[model samples]
Target: MKHLTETEIADWVTGLHTPAILRHVEDCPECRERARTLASALQLFRESAREWADNRTPPVRMIPARRPKPWAVRWAVPAVALALLVSVPVYDSYRRDRQARAETALAARQAAEEAEDAALLSQVDTGVSRAVPAPLEPLVSLVSWNSGSWNASAGQ
Candidate 1:
């Protein structure tokens, strides 16, 4: 007769063996002793595990307190204030430069328009003055008999 293996004995201890293995164990003395030993060991382990699970307790934990920040780290606010104070004047100067450029452009445009008007007026005055020469003065006075300079009442 062949002897049962350790796995067959473990299966028999756990009551999971087939009918053939069970019959073999019943007839074989060596296999029967092995199955008995394995069963007793498994029973002892299960009892110990149950007792440990029932009697176990959770462990306690502790948390530490927070510390304050250093002095140099707290100086960030004043440093930012000083940066703003320095940049304000530079920004204002840039704005004033842009305004001055706009005003200069406006003045130059007005001066060019005034010069164009003066040139036009001079052309008109020159044309009108040249239209009446010195040789036509007497003919102009005779045609303008009703003029105040040649009054008929003054002759009377």
Candidate 2:
């Protein structure tokens, strides 16, 4: 049988022993002695640590949590109500100011759009009022066909 490794010995201390470990430890005297020595050393260390904690460490005092004063609790609701009452008129004033600014912005935008529409209509009216386009005026004098000689209704 193979002897338990240093890690296996540690695992035994931590209660991680398998059936194989049990059988080996029972059968192997050398391994059993080694396990006992390691266990004894750990127990001594644990005892010393507990002794140090008990003797050397300072005691901790837990301070109780502070409660709110009765007067503060009594006035809390009225204070909140007063705050809400004061805030209502201020909030309404802010809302009206914002609405007025938005209305002004909308009116300005509408006036600009009306001006643009009027300018476009004036340009269209100028174009429509002309008898012929300026570019086509030069071509009009070149035509020899008189209006009385030709008719669109007859092919001739």
Q: Per-residue error at 132 for model 1, in Å? A: 98
Candidate 2 accuracy as lDDT: 0.82
Clashing pairs in 2: none
Query: How much is the lDDT of residue 87 in candidate 2?
Result: 100
Q: Report the lDDT of model 1 for residue 135.
A: 78
lDDT of 2 by residue, 28-83 (tens): 99999999999999999977766766675483333554566769978999999999
Q: Provide the TM-score for each candidate, comma-separated.
A: 0.36, 0.48
| Predicted candidate 1 versus true structure: per-residue lDDT over 34-153, tens digit per residue | 889888888898778767766767522323434345465478788889899999999999999999999999999999999999999998887778746767865665553654565444
Count of clashes in candidate 2: 0
Which candidate's TM-score is highest? 2
Q: Highest lDDT: give the candidate number.
A: 2
